[model samples]
Target chain A: MGNRTPLYEEHLRANAKMVDFGGWDMPINYGSQIEEHNQVRQDAGMFDVSHMTIVDLSGDKVKPFLQYLLANNVDRLKDKGKALYTCMLNEQGGVIDDLIVYYLGETFYRMVVNAATREKDLAWIEKHAAAYDVTVNVRDDMAMIAVQGPNARDKAHKVLGVAIADQLVDIKPFFMREMGDVIVARTGYTGEDGYEIMLPANQAPGTWRQLVEAGVKPTGLGARDTLRLEAGMNLYGHDMDENTTPLESGLSWTVAWEPEDRDFIGRAALARQKSEGVKRKLVGLVLEDRGVLRDHQKVIVDGEEAGEITSGSFSPTLGKSIAFARVPASVGTHCQVDVRGKLLNARVVKLSFVRNGKPCIDV
Target chain B: MSNIPQELRFTKSHEWVKREEDGTLVIGITDHAQQLLGDLVFVEVPEAGSSFKDSDDCAVIESVKAASDVYCPVAGEVIESNEALADAPETINNDPYGDGWIFKLKPEDEGAYDGLMDADAYAEVVAEDEH
Candidate 1:
């Protein structure tokens, strides 16, 4: 048996096929994954993402503590409700977990980390906070639901009522605002304009039902995977992990290094790698052959092993199979993905295969 | 009516075999197999002239999520294959027992279907797997 979310009964009512995801039984798909993928890309869809862990950091020392804890600078979040996406690193410069931190006030900040890495993340936050006057508090009482699409913000507001929904227009990207008890953030994982709502667990089911009744289609994890892939966002366990670093995982841009005096946990290791140059680099792959690109397949570049795919899937938006591969930094435009022992040619392009429902490459 | 047909036989791996009157056998992945694979995206059937032993990898069904191999339910030469699936593989999801059939084979031996499970047995197997 696995843990069930507050909306599990609602998912069952909608005939969602449940799958065990990190000990939590959740919906993989409501019916057709492809259809649900299109709904989010074309219209509106909501996802129950409460399985992700949330923690609150407090005290006047919160800002300083986060500066030493995360790879990205916390000072970038100058305004209240501003959010910053960053990766927490180990001493060896390997990524421990990637998370989004929301700056709420002078003494408090909120963070949502991956479910599988919750234990380590909590431990790391606590262990590092001991030197400062900060306190680490986990927010297990909140349930999060993400409504994403071009019209997602509009629909979510209409369903929640015009008075509350009207405030959504002013919530800029990577910013959040609280409406009554709901923490509505203008953020999303699907590379679309929308909001991620966080509320009490007991209120989640009713809120989900209300949103669904207001014409927001219920989406599942299957669509979530493909949508994130199409958006060029990395999956926690697949695209990168404890053994991988942000520099080699196409997330180098997220790192902040300016003041020579500011020493983060993995600063020295990353600084050394930065000076010496990185060995492997993560790049996007586009198939030119009749076959699809898949993960764990050997990537032959110039008839030699360049790298293997970290995450691969058939993109619903592009109608083709694409992948993210960690290849040699020197590897160029042409590569071959071995599928079923045969090398299928693929072209290496910059990441973000599909953005805002359009192809980044010229097809 | 959507259960495995009584006239056909099944393997433990979930392939269905329909032995024709002329000794030619029609082969396909069972409906249970298609359901497990989710939405079909591509089908890689064997060449018509290729011969295979029972339980050999004779075909492949690629879904939007994953790829699975379709084994030869009965050993024989593949006399014909359903090429219609190459353009649109969703037929397998819509009609797995009929239009979604993969290949036709002439059995090398008459007792090829004898060792396979009956329709009732295959249905029971699917039911048990649902747990």
Candidate 2:
């Protein structure tokens, strides 16, 4: 048995296939995974992201504390409700977790971390905060839901009412606004226009039912993974882990290097790595053959094992297979993947396979 | 409960076998099996003229979640393989019984086919596992 979110009963009512995801009994899909993936690309879809951990920080020195905590500079979040995507690193320059931090006020920020890395992330944050005067508050009573697609904002506004909808439409992307107990943010993992709503857990079930009635199809973890992959978003445990650095994980852009004196936690290690030259690079792969590419498959470059795939799947939008591989820096645009003892041809492209409901690379 | 056609024979591993009028045996995964595996992304059928023993793993079927092996119910040589699935594997999900047939086998011994379980028995096997 595992923990169930507030919408567990709703998922059951929709005939969802339940699976244990990172110790939470979450829905893998309501029905067909491909259909759910397509729905988010072409129309509106809702995902219960309540299993993610939310931590609120407040203090006189909260801004400076965040500057030394995250890899990206929080000093850039000058406007209220501005959010930044960054990696939290350890002393060894390895990722503790990737998170989104929203600056709500001068002394307050709301952060969301991955569900599987919740405990470790909290401990790291708390330990680092002891030196500063910041207070770390975990809001377990809050539930999150992400509604995403081309028409997602309109559908979400219809369910959330007119005033809130009007305010949400005016909010810029990667920005959020608080309305009573609900926080509506124009952020999404599916690379589509939508909002990620966080509200009291007790009020979640009713809101979910209303969204369903508004014709926002219910999606689950399976479709979420495919959608994120198509958008070229890096999953925490899959694309990188504690032992992998941001430089090797296609996350160098997330690290802020300006004002060299920022003196972040992993700054020294990253500086040392950069001077010595990074060894590996993350690249996207599209299988030109008839088989599906999968994780941990050996990547053959010039007839030798040069790398391995971190995430791979069939692209529902492209009607082919694609993957993310961490290969040697010298590897070229063409390589072969060893699938079940057969070497198949694949083409390397930019990090993302699809973006904004369209193919980012050639089909 | 999934649809279990009464006339076809079944294996505990979820493969369904049907004997053609020409004495060749046609095989595919059962509806219950395809439903459990979700959408099919790839299917690797055995090449024609290949031989296998009873209960031998002869083919590979993959979904987005995991991969599963389809075993040969009876010892036989492959007569025809379903090449159409190579381009569009979702046929197994759309029509798991008729157009989704995986392959045809020339059985080494006709009696070996009788040793497999019937539709009702296979249904019981699936039902017991669900609990």
Candidate 3:
């Protein structure tokens, strides 16, 4: 048996196929995963993302604590409700986790981390925050719902009150605002305009039902993965882990290197790695052959073991197999993937495959 | 509550078989199997003229979430394959018992076809898995 989320009953009622994901009994998909994926890409779909941990840090020194903890500097977030996507690195420069931090006030910052890394993330934050006088509060009472796609915001707004909907309409991208008791952020993983709403756990069922009645299709984790992958977003465990640094995980852009004096954790290691030069790189692969590309498949660059695929799948949006692979820096626009016993030809492209329901690369 | 057609024979691996009038055996993954695999994105069928022993893995089915093998119930030579699935893999999800038929084989031993499970026996096998 696995831990059940607040929306477990709601999922069961919707006839969802539940699976054990990171110790939680969550819906993989309600029905056809491809249809659900298309729903989020073309229409509106809602995901019960409550399994993700929500940690709030509050104290006068919270700003300094975050600046020292995350690789991305939070000093750029001057406005309230502004958010920053960053990776937390270990002392060895390997990624501990990737998270989103929202600045709510001068002394308060809220962060949402991956579900599988909850315990470790909380422990890391608490251990480092002791010297900064920041109190770590896990928001277990809240349940998160990500409503995404092209018409996601408008349909979701119909479920919200007029005043809240009006404010939500003006909330810029990567920004969030609290209305009454709910925090609505104009952000999503599907590379579409939408909102990630955090509300009381007890009210989650009612809100989900309201959204369903308003034409928001209930989706699950299966679509969430393909959506994020199509958008060229990196998943924490697959793309990078405690053994991989952000520099090799295609997350170097997220690292704030400016104001070099600001000492953050793993800063020295990252600087050293940068000075020495990174040997491998993360690139996208589009299979030119018939078979599907999958994780751990060997990437053969010029008949040699260049690297391996981190995440691969048949992209419903592109109608082809695509993957993220760590390969030698010399790898160019073409390569081959070893699927089963066949060395299938593939084309290397930019990290992103699809964005906003359109193919980012030429078909 | 997966549909187990009364007229067809089944394999323990969730494949369903129907003996055609011309002595060829048509096969496909059962409805219950398709339900378990979700929507299939790709189907790799064995080409005609390939020989296989009983219980040999004859085809591959891939979904967005997983990949599974379809085993041959009895020793046979491949006679034909459902080539339409190359363009529309979702046919298996839509009608696993009908148009979703995967391949046809000319059985080497006719008696081996009778050894396959009947609908009621296959139902018991499926029931055991639920627990």
Candidate 4:
């Protein structure tokens, strides 16, 4: 009863368990979620990310417009195809949405934002672009597929054929290359080496089938959540929202404050918060006992509620439970999580638990 | 269609009960229930000798997707709890009717097992839910 992506039929053919995700009926998993998670970590896997929104911004003032609009400096993208991950902030220093912008040309840039935040993001971009005369084009005719893992690139290259593969040989991480009508970016949400391919919507099913034939296992949104959580990536609406700033959401590194004169939106508020010091901070938690860490669980420090978990789940790779909690800056390494009326012991760790199919933290 | 053993009795909530020759009852979640919960990672079974009323929330099953409560089908005292599931919770997903049984219970009323839904009736419940 919801919106269906270009690959919806393919998902049904694969016996995927479909669920409503941000207004689109997408696959939660094909069969076992843990199996799909392990497949992506150990070998190659493909995901139907066609529901994501793609926008193209163009005009002579595009560069300057982005400089004022994004929290991260757009000047850092010096080369063509280079991508920068940044947060678009409101006037009050709250994060509107986080996105990746790729430098295509002097007057043109491509952006991929979260699907749920598409309408608001487009409205905000258009509202600010009027003064700069930048044109915004939403590419609804496109579909995206992400192929990930250690063997992901090789498997994807096999499906893309020799000519397209040859053009991507020199592609670096966070860089994109256009092969005829397709744009392949060496980037992905999963903490693995992969490419997120964007092409015509009608060609998505064929491309997905080709990748599957090449032995890339089809993954779903369930595995994507666990993989991204292990990668220490912040999911929109969960880790942070329009009410929270990037500084408090463990995303301080994404803010570019190098050019003190560059007065981007929310710069003054963030500067004030920086000078005053941020009281609350986001940190990672590893359950020391046998239990699953879930979202909205209260984080108890010394028998008092100090914070709450923003995102939590069982880590298939680690064989343990992990979570992201926003606690007082003074909270120590040890805390307890209120899991269904029981306070279980937990140890605080760095943001990431796994990377490159290996454990980043001590098990 | 999900596997529904003809010898077993079921509750509307998907718990299956099998009356043993000794009057003790073995209970577990149905195949349809495990399929709905996805891969089970953690299970909290009732302790042996624990008493519960009918329809009481007595056990917990946590999957990668969400945590679900296993309700007590009838008023009974637990005779034994399956401890193996603490280490291998996916046993329920693999063999829901046999080795994945959660607990053995001695019902308070001798005729309580007969009051539960039969295999054919439980099939109708599952069919109604699929829509």
TM-score of 2: 0.98
True A-B contacts kept by model 2: 0.69
* Candidate 4: CAPRI quality band: high
After the best TM-score superposition of candidate 4, give how far the Cα of residue B48 lies from its true spot, in angstroms: 1.1
lDDT of 3 by residue, A168-202 (tens): 77789999999878999988898888999999999
Q: Which rank order by TM-score, best down to worst?
A: 4, 3, 2, 1
Please give, for residues A1-363, the per-residue lDDT of candidate 1 as tens digits.
787888899999998989988878989998788889998998899999989998999999999999999999988889999999999999988999999999998899999999888888888889889999899889988999999998788788877777777777777899999788889998889988889999999999999998898788999998999899888999888888888889999999889997778889888998898889999999999887766677788899999987999988788787778899999999988999999888999989888987777778867
Q: TM-score of each candidate?
A: 0.97, 0.98, 0.99, 0.99
DockQ of 1: 0.58
Which 10 consecutive residues of model 4 chain A have the lowest summed lDDT?
A44-53
Off by over 4 Å in 1: none
Kindly list the per-residue Cα lDDT of model 4 for residues A34-134, writing each as its tens digit.
99999999999989998899999999999999999999999999999999999999998999999999999999999999988988999999999999999
Predicted structure 1: lDDT = 0.88
Greater-lDDT candidate between 3 and 4: 4
The true-versus-predicted C-alpha distance at residue A222 of model 1, in Å, is: 1.4
Better candidate number, 1 or 2, judged by DockQ: 2
TM-score of chain A as modeled in candidate 4: 0.99
What is residue B108's positional error in candidate 3, in angstroms?
0.9
> What's chain A's TM-score in each predicted model?
0.98, 0.99, 0.99, 0.99
How large is the interface RMSD of each prediction? 1.2, 1.0, 0.8, 0.5
